[model samples]
Target: MEALQSVYIPGSRFLPTKRNMRMKAIDSEVQHSIRRIVNNRIKAMKAEEGNYDDLLGVMLESNIKESRAREEILNVLGDQNVDTDGLNQLKVVNMIFYEVLRLYPPFVGIARKADKDITFEGFSLPSGTQIALPIILLHYDEQLWGSDANKFKPERFSEGISKATKNQVIYFPFGWGPRICIGQNFALLEAKIALTMILQKFSFELSQSYVHAPHIVLSLQPQYGARLILHKLQ
Candidate 1:
């Protein structure tokens, strides 16, 4: 139900409404089945013999580093009792992801159907009409992002998401509003943890053969696959 509702399918919205009790029941069953499968896979992982260094392990390691950093900060201040929950020393990692999202959002555009007639910016939109929101264009607009809009500037997000641009609405890589993607937080946290682990383990740069063109087929992707030269850290 979650995946179907989010993905652009033929009749997703029309399928499992309050009026369609039968379909709703089926949807619930499908969701349960997916959860059961995921739990089983986790159990299988726990049952395995060999050691594995995965995202969860990496996050656990990061948690230890965070504790140490917190203690160091407390020692410097001579106040060990101060709360450290609000501190975020890993904010730079977040900025890197923000810049990546600005340059190449997962979805090039999102479609919305208008149920009623509306007028905006001197343009009229009739009822029962569909519109494609050009997200990347808005993301890269110089008016909002300043003269260096074309450049990859992760430092822009150092002050936080709200201050990243003059108009905060312009940065909606996960879409916006009540109908925004349900898994937005999950996706962001996953990316942050993965990027943090990668940076900790290796140094990497774009390969000489790398291509920069981006295209979309359902979701935005590189026209040619990204090539990187990774050097492992000891």
Candidate 2:
């Protein structure tokens, strides 16, 4: 853990080759942890009965119209007071994911180098200059997200991404423009599916043992761990 923490220090690369070796070890552990979580979710899904009426079912059935799918889902869940349809519920899930990303982006910062001289606003940058684009800084800016920028509020995204921020550039959790993450949609869908399945079977809340500290290595994660008290639903 100490070695992993050291890797986050600025200019840590200037250290000895032994330090680089430690980084590889920490990275491997991180990768293994992620794979374990994904594999467990996949195994659980596969073990489920073929008859599913939730989000996964909709996905598996394929080619259903958005509104029709929502209707089917609402029927399966027996939820009448929701007022909103399945599509809107999906939107709410997406917004929740967006809020999570805003608080803790996977790539906290991305670097870009200037190929030639350029001017933006009133500032000038010469060729061969490197720029650090700290996306998390923009994600939490008061001007873009209002007074509650630091707090978790998925409702802020109810209107959609374009209208959520003061400027479009302030909300790039997966990078922006042509250089954006190619697997962004896939990643989000994977998360959405897993979250849906979990929510379907269980209700959960933070346990007394839960810690709120978020630490960043390659990605943001709970420093102590996310301890939750879960209750299985009928």
Candidate 3:
């Protein structure tokens, strides 16, 4: 992919080359088209009173809805510091984390090698063949996650990961199987603790200048960085 190449190939983005210029033009066009489509959709939604029933419509209809998550955390831990037991009880918070990770997985992809010759979906590959799994693509796949896959509906994980993924290899923010990240639980626990502490004292929203630009270096990151305005709770 050109985007991947731009990141992996040294000096490709900065070099004044034909390929780089073409990529930039293509990227600009894609951005402009996406912006136009979204703006048109917003305008259409405003002009209509009918139900949307699509991803964009759902997103526009959805509200912050963080009160439930905050209330769940408060009920589980009150003003106390987050503990393992309390963290486990914060179901809504856990769902929010799962949804966030699904949308913005830290790693865009994962690499693996076939230990032995294998046949998959009519393709036969010899041993030692390399495979690259695109996590972001899989996460956003409509067939795997239904039509509203792009929306931030955390309730999908309400019944747990198994139900959310239909007992498939579709969802894996920290990779899957035996080679899954060993620190997955620890990392999530750390995040839960930090989030719990913050929610206990403040409410936050995106700042006016915040720009949503998810880019991948080694891992997925916000290109412009996330800017938030936090309000202290009295």
Best by TM-score: 3
- TM of each candidate vs. truth: 0.60, 0.62, 0.73
- Tens-digit lDDT track for model 3 on 110-158? 9999999999999998999999999999999999999979877788999
Judged by TM-score relative to the true structure, which candidate is superior, 1 or 2? 2
lDDT per residue, candidate 1, 153-213, as tens digits?
5668878888887556898889898889899878877765555445545556566686768
Candidate 3 C-alpha error for residue 100, in Å: 0.7
In every candidate, how many clashes are there? Answer: 0, 0, 0
| TM-score of model 1 vs. true structure | 0.60
Please rank every candidate by lDDT, starting with the best.
3, 2, 1
TM-score of 2: 0.62
How well does model 2 score by local distance difference test? 0.69
- Per-residue error at 138 for model 1, in Å? 0.5
Ranking by TM-score: 3, 2, 1
Tell me the tens digit of each residue's lDDT in model 2 across 13-53: 65667867787789899999978865554455456433335
Considering only N, C-alpha and C atoms within 3 Å, which residue pairs clash in candidate 2?
Answer: none
Q: How far is candidate 3 from the true structure (C-alpha RMSD, Å)?
A: 15.5
Whole-model lDDT per candidate: 0.67, 0.69, 0.83
Q: Name model 3 segments beyond 4 Å from true.
A: 1-63
